[model samples]
Target: MTALQRIEQGSALQQTDDADLVARIDMLNAIGIALSSENDMPHLLERILIGAKQITRADAGTLYTINDQQKLNFEIVQTTSLGIKRGGSSARPVQLEPISLYRGNGSPNNKLVVTYCALNNKTVNLPDVYKENDTGFDFSGPRLFDKKMNYRTRSMLCVPMINHDGKTIGVIQLINKKSINGPVAFDDDDIHLLQSLASQAAIALTNKRLIDDLKALFDSFIKTIAASIDETSAHTGEHCRRVPYLTLALADAASRDQKCMKDFILNKQQRYNLEVASWLHDCGKLATPIHIVDKSTKLETVFDRIELIDTRFEVLKRDANIARLEALLEAGHDKDRIELIEKQYREEIKQLTDQRDTIRQCNIGAESMPPELKERIKQIAARTWRNCDDELVPFFSEDEINNLLIPYGTLNADERKIINDHIVVTNKMLASMQFPDEMASVPEYAGGHHERMDGKGYPLGLTREQMSVPARVMAIADVFEALTSWDRPYKKAKKLSEALAILGKMKQRNHIDPDLFDLFIRDKVYLPYAREFMDPELIDIDEPSEIPGYPFDMP
Candidate 1:
């Protein structure tokens, strides 16, 4: 051949090399971006191995991450020739045991190639494992695997993944560099490309780990606050914990409802946010007074004031006995007069006993106080009794009268206001926090649980139109949990049938979301929750049709 022709041929070869180098660089850039963007650990690890194999044209690859125990854990394993895939997002799990960094004798286990690469922060490129006798690393495990799979064990490359902090985080092992002709060795270019991929993978893995650790810490902190709120009241101690489970369950059910909730769906992040919001829903109850929270009766404060009223009744009986004795002394044993005085004394004692019993019953608050009962309380309070100072005072205090006259539940207007203020505090507390963008709606979701659809709710009277679906879902969960919780002091836990009946009424009155309530009943979301958290006897509903407000034709 002519010298000029030879020079032209060499120039053409050099140009081809330059073009290939550019293509490989472009591929590396794309792979780096892909690795950094992945948030899921398993998928990221899998992608790292797959990307490595693609860049090096390898037949198989395995990715190993260093666990907290200083051991190499097989995160991803794939072999194209064998069509074997395990770990990561694969259904098949890696059954291989972890490679310990240290042996039983407390010495670094550098006998294996992957571990040696990780410990020394070096790369080992074996042209052929079968031919290499001076490498000083054990290939027995690969040999055994190859023997079992009926495959040749040749051409190995192991690279240590070193992060920005100059610490080795994992190892990547590639097998059998493949060409069009056959399996070949991993050359210098292959080593450099694998090293670059390993560096990016290391950073991605480390960032994910940091973010996960932070997330774990944040979740624990939120739960700790919830648990502290529960600790404030024995009667409602489980309220904070149970609401989250019920909220998530109902939310999931709503997501599946195609009829009414066709547009309602919670993505993974949104669902996570809802779960977090549910956990923090009642965090403000942490500031509520324990006395008011555990108030079991109308006249309850620090303790039951009914016992004090009992003392007063005893005082009145003593006064009546004194009067009866004085009258008998004046009559001087006159039979008719003595009989009349004794009869008068007995009637007075009976009336006072009746009045005392009435007061005791009123102190035990009910769902509603009868007007006649209130009048009765007032009448009894009008009667005067001598105090320790000998001054005449009404039988019942004004404060006690007001407490006994509470129309519903144990809390009076002022006490109820105090209780309602917790939602406001919850909103403020959550608003003050700088949550991530995905959880920005947590404050609204958590605080709006008490809101009514008719714009009559407290803290913020958000109408149904103004509230989000998650908020409404949380409201239903809150009420249902309260209704079925067995730990309440004043009222017994209602059976599932009764709770559903009441919830149905609530839906009709626009107190809760109608669609979500229907979905809750239609899907039987309450059944699983009831079975898990409620007493088995409380689940007494025989049929859905028996429940009040249940639409018989509901799809």
Candidate 2:
């Protein structure tokens, strides 16, 4: 043949190979997409295990997830079914029969030569378990063929799943690739390609683990901060913890209605920004002072203004007794009869004590005080405690924001103003902090947390339309954590039921977006959350959903 003719024919062959290569790339890409898309590990494993069998045209396969202890953990995410007669066309989804699987070869006696992969961290391929190197788990596959419904293991391939850290997360085993009514062993090319896929899968799994670890760390830091806030104020001990939990719950519900955060184009930096937004939602609290945050009673810190009313009672008792004695004397009662007049003095004192007790009753109660109660407090406080020896006792503590007049969300008017100003603090804190260029938007997401749906929220007052999806997600996570946490002292920790109900009402009143609340209710997102922080015994699924409106916030 002419040289040109030879080159043309060679080009055609190369083109065919190129087309096949493209097809393989597409398949691998699809598998990678499936693996990385899910946060749930089992589902991800199922997808890969099924892909491994179908791509290799194998009859059965097993996927294992290895732990830090160098053990194999079988995922219930994948299962098997046998006894399918070729002509008996069945119409049911294949049942994944429960395979009793464990981490590490349970007693190390099984012949899957787990040691083979452990030592080599490489692929093992066999033409048949009945012959050849009998070193691995091959014995079990063929034995199953011999004992169960008649089938023989013709070829087997096993590959280690090594994460990015160069540690093996687990192994993937594919069995019996059929070639013309009999099994065919996997070739070098198949092993090489499968190895590549396994490597990619490992990286994805490692990514997920890192995410989980980061979240745990963030939660730990927030818990420590909440404890500090609690410790700073006598009355606000638990408030800091509870608010973040509630905020997170609310944010979770809101996300369902709002946009669920999307993994942005696999950008690591963007991923970081999303996480930062959630963890630092309450970093703004660091700017708020302790005395202002935990102020419980209206007249707290400066004095137990109640003491002033007691003084008034004492004066009233003295006046009443003096009058009663004077009347008795004017009526011709002599000094010898003074003991009879003294009885009236004792009765007056008893009445004043009873009235004082009633005034004290309404002060400590958590519920809202009506105008009558307010008026009563005003009248009694006006009476003056001549005993107060202070300049205004400093209510502001380092970690606690105790402003009694705050009426109990966390800050009083000036304190609330200071607390709200934390948005500015967060904005400045995050904006000045450097991040990789990809996550430059982190500060934007973090700072807008206090912004409201109605443009009434502080700092920016961003409406729902103006907020980014990341900010919305932060908003949910922030609210959920606040409501459900046990670290706050201002109020009792709200159960998932109470928190959701409150969020639902907020959504109804236009304070929070509604769609996210629906998602929070439907997905039971709090189930996993409850398992994380609360004692299992305290988790009450029957928690009441009755959310009474905040008297002041209600229209």
Candidate 3:
């Protein structure tokens, strides 16, 4: 019989005589719900193909999704009679060439059965492919398979999986519907059932692809922000990349800790969220001024103001020389008096030179500056010097004096506040965003990294009890990265031993999370990280036993 005649007969049989029709309808509804609930792409595609085969009792089927090149890309293929499965979750991959939906000249490719279904957005039922010759599609693929497998090319059903927008996204093809007797033509009842299932599959696939695209876009956005922040300082850029690695590594280690298994272990979503938080922790630094961040010396602003102070010292030397010359000219008639005046002038110039050297030394930042030295800065500031207006003024301005008197680090109090305010800005920026439920803790974890265990840290003085484990994980990562980092403007990278010692001290003083620090040492997370990212010379062979407060005996 012709393909059309067979379809008409199947439709008549479907309406009047099928006792199992109600059961099939219920099965179709259940399959649709199952397909809709599947979120995994490979599993979903596999389920779609499997569902169509079971409903039609087909011996074989192939699921194909359209690619950007307008080709029918085989996503899943299964053959029950041959025990063949490829693609989707199968160990074997689909090696078949994608069927083109458009030829080189861009005309519709209607010669292939799958392409024909996708192009026309309609189902094709062939009762017997070997006997049919009137259909516009080529059956060479199935004919070749039959020849190779010693199988017969018989009944077929090809349905277009169309999305809600009425666009064909893919095609579902079933071959050789099997019955108790042998291969039989897929009837209109089977055709209608497969089409309904294909429709649900298309919507599910579309929604999944859309969600995947959005996730990809969101990841790119985060990376772009990180790159932008990194571009602001060549020194800080490496920190942005390395800290995330360390954060995730430490987190993974913590997750494996048997003592705190319940508290520390992370699910896949939680791990992802922690990783995202680590990458974004320093995003607030984007708001901090580059000059302050790169300030290598105490007197630095746009440029070091120390040079301006040096010019004033030179002016004082010149004034002293003029006075000495004037005295020499006046005392020319008195030799002994002239000698005394010259000696006094030389001594006065020597004092000014000493003071100038002291100020220059003070300009360099150190771990600590003494009170005595700070008082001398005030003394130096009081020394009189003539301005362009000829009015005498203090040798150093109030702001310059304050910068020079900074007891620790390059930044003065106001500049330090500006730098610290980045955390505040970071909190605000992340808090304002609406994250998915899986990532809702991103703001909290990222914002609390700077907070100390003893409530001594900035932006918010959140104590250990208030902070989450992930937040504490970030805090340790941030501290360690900064300590061993060679990219800072003012300080050299600390050796592994030195960095760990400082961290140990911080733990002893309640400056960081002690339990996490112990795990960091016991787990040996630092060694591998240091080998990868630290300068070779800085990677020392200090044992965890030697690190103070590391609790080497802890189980």
Candidate 4:
């Protein structure tokens, strides 16, 4: 009977211990929520420290992170009344020992200690610090105990904060367990609680580190790309620089434009796309030969077409000479015939000089090719002169070279096509690109910049209904920069009044959204935008167009 009673008692004791362990698990859960939710790292650490002391009945606590150099560092992230209050700021981190220090080989005196906790990546319990050999290294962490903090050392229970990657970030050392009634064993319950909290802290620290690293890399990348594009040309100056600024502005504008743009609101993912789009919109221009982009006049490529007309003048001169020579022969008037032919030559030359004036101001049509112009080509073909690399594809293809005829802007027809195709190239280039999950929408948004409200845009003429908010925002920013920018190849910039008037007309034509334009100007979006990237001379309101000399009609 006595033996049986003793067995029953042992069983009961085991059950009680299990219950105690389970309760400790529940308490740790409560503390985990608090630690994880707290954005203030110091406060979270302090709360966690207090919870640790409560679980273990520890007299004090200290947390330390190991540095890349494998040194033990202090992070008095939290502590309880061995009576020290956390110094208002977060504790400076130190590294006295690394993961390397924890193995049995490193001299304990040669470096800070990483005991059993570091080796197994688990908790280590010591009933009394005074009884053990001092591992030959400094174990000092600040304390609130009487006298010198270094003088006090006691039993410690430490847990390593090992992240999912199996890297140990720091160690939580619970020192001097003390119960209200008296000292209690730093039992399994206490070990379990500290381990759980350490786990949570590990994840937070790892996440913070990853996020910081990514941000640094992204900023560096943005700066490098911007610098590279700026190096391309003097004209692309402030123009490219202002893209991101205005993109953000348009994003904000779109954000406030009610539900019409509700789906386009630049959430986290959309903003990421905008960031890449704004930087890379003109990337295709990088591939374009320099002369074409800056082809200030129609004849700019290799030979001025105007010069070809001069050759026609040569033909007309010969024709006049032939007529004079024939007339003199018939009249038997040789006395002044040679001199008369020479005078006729001079008169023909004078006529040809003004011959180019009419053609220079000829009416260029829209993108469409005009049959009349093709016929004119036949008449002008008779006047061909020096041809040098004239047939090369200087710009993009056009059906009828409509805009070429009108010269609404400086672009003679061909240069206009090259400029227009920039968007097409932008689309094709971006289409092949692969943005990460967070930025997957980039190709669509950047490519849609030229899209019109009435489906009149090129490449893909997605109507306003099909266009995304990001695309619309890009459109607004693109136009805003083109109008207000201080750099370009041709044509003096129109007054703000004129630029806005054109955009307003576009709005009326259903080529642009009226509400968005109104919002853009009314908000004075360009004021601060100009401040950010415009050169001092360009920013001056007095004919801001003169700096770049707003293209008579920018291609």
Candidate 5:
């Protein structure tokens, strides 16, 4: 055969016919599509390096990415012959020093071949680095590496990965082409194929990085909004922070359960979805008024109206004293008559003091006010007193009457409705955001946390079957945080036992998820959660049986 024919036929051991060449090109095209579709940076980078090595049959390879500091970072390295690997799928980091693209004087670094290729946007095809003298690039580092690792330093093909804007983002370095007989130098075909792969890889990497940057920006925006909401109420800021953690913890526990692992297991994207949802669960509270949110007593509005009531009681006492003195004056100099009038005056004062004390006690709104207390409030409200208008009027106005008549908590019905409207606002606010496919369920999951399992929840009356596990988990987290929280103005932080008992009762009444509650108790999700977020004093230990509805034995 002629010498030309022999060369055109390619190497005898690694023969490449027209058909084989076409098949490899087709495979390269398929790999390019796959690379572009990969969203993960680490995996995409690993795939790029591995794909280059596979196509060229290189025994060793290294991938470098250019950093903002004008340095080439060693991202992935692989040497198959010695079973040496670092970074990427090896789960180990590459410890090699970075190559700087510029020197201290701000001159382009052209000594190292990788840095030179990246600086010039050129491809370096060195058949044998030890014998190369054409480019005047340094090979001392490779020689030292070969000596230290006891490896041969032969052919090298370095290709610059250029993005759409003709900027070099990285370099792909391939070492020693392997064959059945011995190591072979890289040829023109290898160089051309690798360059094409490098181009596709550059675009893919650039796209993935862009996506990552955008995701980071979006998350920052979400957190900023959540932080603003938290800032609106001092008491709820920590609550906002704690619920996400508890949600993740309980969700993770549920994911590990053997009984329903298939149904509950979360992928990386789904976990992120749930986490973002948990953080934004109570964002609707931002629209609520601070006065209603911080109302600590029934008569509180700018300040406690109970103070004004006390002033009125003082006026009544003053009037009683004046009437007693006038009656004594009318009795003239009769000592027995004066003593009787004075005795009656003392009784009147005692009764007035008792009524003042009763009204003060009713204003506190600490516990549930009984029917008789409410009725007594109405009767006391009916008693006439002279006002600044110089007309006899009821001691308590109608509005005050309504406020003091609140059967439970500090807020009246209207204020409670205002508080509940926040969830509706939250649903509306999140619904307007254009979430990506991976996080599409964020709104639904976050919005449903306030909904009841029995269809009694406000805004949207969703039933148990209508809610997702993540949403249900969020509900539990929200309730648990509120129950154990000491910062709220309306209620004291319950002990761990008390909180669990309330949760148990909620489970029994279908206010929360029963199966999830059982799993929560069984897996002891609350203990670790309390340790992380709850006060040490609030973590009171108790038996599962003593908790109102905790299931002792796991099914």
Candidate 6:
């Protein structure tokens, strides 16, 4: 061979190596972009290991992450030659136990190559595991694994994934570097490339974990607020908790409804936003007065005022008895006159007792207050009684009379307004928050639960067209949860049939979203929700047709 020919051959090999280096650099750039974008932890971990294998031409690889217990857990495992795949989106589980970072004596366990790489935050490259004895890493586990699978363990490379903080979070180990001829040792280029890849992987992983931890903290904080609101009033019970469950369930059903909800589909981020909105729907109730929230009776404030009214009635009876006694003394033993005075006193006492009983019943705040009953309350209010200061006052105070005449439920008009204002406050509170773009609609969704479909709802009075689907879905969820909640002080929990019937009427009256309500019944979204949250005794409905708004006739 001529000297010129040999020089040309060397030049050709150098060019090929340069081209390969350029290609590998481009691949690394692409892999970095992918690792940064991947949100799923498992998929991200798998991608890191796979990308390292592709760059080094490795035949098999395993990825391990350090857990809180100071142990290495297998996150992703792949062996191309054996056709073995486990973990990281694969249905097959990684059945191996974790490798503890420390021994029982509290010393670092640096015997295993992966752990050694992790513990030392260093890269380990082995030309041949069977022949390499100076590095002092135990190869018995790999040898046993290879023997069990009838495969050879050779040409290994392990890299520590060090984050920006200089902490080794995990390790990536590659086995059997592949070549056109057969297995070959990983060289300096492979080690450098893998070390760079490991750094990028670590950063991506740390960022993802940090974001996940922040989200978890935010979620727990939101739930804690909801729980605190529930704890503020015994009457509210689990309304805050159950509404989110039903809201998500109904939203899921709507999303799956291809016919009606083609445009109503929610992606993962949208669903999460809706979940946040649902969790914070009643957050404004936190500002509500506890007396109104826990108003078990019409006369309920800090305490029931009926006892005060009862005492006033007793004073009136005492005055009537005093009048009868003075009249009898003035009669001077006229028998017929005495009998008539005694009759008048007895009749007066009975009437006072009946009026007191009537006031007591009125304070209970039944579903409806009859006009006659209201008039009776006014008549009782007109009667006079002397106070402890010896001044005559009306039998009932004006406030007492107003409370007793409440047309329906425990709350009077003012208290009802206060209760309804919670949604307004919720809007204000959520609006004050600096949410991300994805969650910008939270205030609207949470605040719109009280809105009517026909633009009759409070605060903003958004019509069906003005509101989003999530808001409408929340309206139905809120109403249904309230109707079926057993802990409400004013009313008994309605049976499933009764609640559905009322919901049907609401749909017909344009009080709630018509399509969502129909979807709710048709898809039987309430069944699982009822089973999970509703009282067992309240779940009495047997058929969809029995539900008031069910549009379909099941065969």
For residue 166, model 5's alpha carbon misses the true position, in angstroms, by 2.6
Sort order, lDDT high to low: 6, 1, 3, 5, 4, 2
lDDT of each: 0.90, 0.61, 0.88, 0.64, 0.86, 0.91
Residue 55: error of model 1 in Å?
1.1
Q: Alpha carbon lDDT of residue 452, candidate 2?
A: 69
lDDT of 1 by residue, 165-282 (tens): 8999999999999989788999888899999999888889999999999999999999999998888788886888899999999999988878899999888888999999999999
Weakest lDDT window of 10 consecutive positions for candidate 2: 395-404
Off by over 4 Å in 4: 1-17, 23-76, 79-158, 162-167, 173-189, 192-235, 238-240, 253-266, 282-291, 302-406, 409-438, 492-501, 537-555
- Global local distance difference test of model 1: 0.90
The TM-score values for the models, in the order shown, are: 0.97, 0.57, 0.89, 0.63, 0.91, 0.96
Better of 1 and 2 by TM-score: 1
Best by lDDT: 6
Task: Please state the error at residue 96 of candidate 1 in Å.
Answer: 1.2
Give me the runs in candidate 2 sitting further than 4 Å from their true place: 1-40, 43-57, 76-110, 133-138, 163-166, 219-283, 302-555
Report the lDDT of model 5 for residue 241: 78
List of clashing residue pairs for candidate 3 = none
Q: Which portions of model 1 show Cα errors greater than 4 Å?
A: 1-4, 549-552
Residue runs of model 6 more than 4 Å from their true location after superposition: 328-339, 548-555
- Candidate RMSDs in Å, in order, are 1.6, 9.3, 4.6, 8.4, 3.0, 1.8
| Model 5 agreement with the true structure over 1-555: per-residue lDDT tens digits | 999888766675356455667777887998898997887787898999988998888999999999999999999999999888888767788998898999999999999899999999999888888889777888898999899999997889999999999999999999998889667898887888899999999999998889889989988887887888777766675777788889998888888887744477777887899999988887888788988887888899989999889888888888888988898889999899999988987897887788889887877776588999988888888887888888988888888999999888888999999999988998998889888777899998899888889999977999989999999999999999988988877678889998998898898889999878888887789998888877898887844655643545655
Candidate 3 total steric clashes:
0
Better of 2 and 3 by lDDT: 3
Collision count of model 6: 0
Which ten contiguous residues of candidate 1 have the minimum total lDDT? 546-555
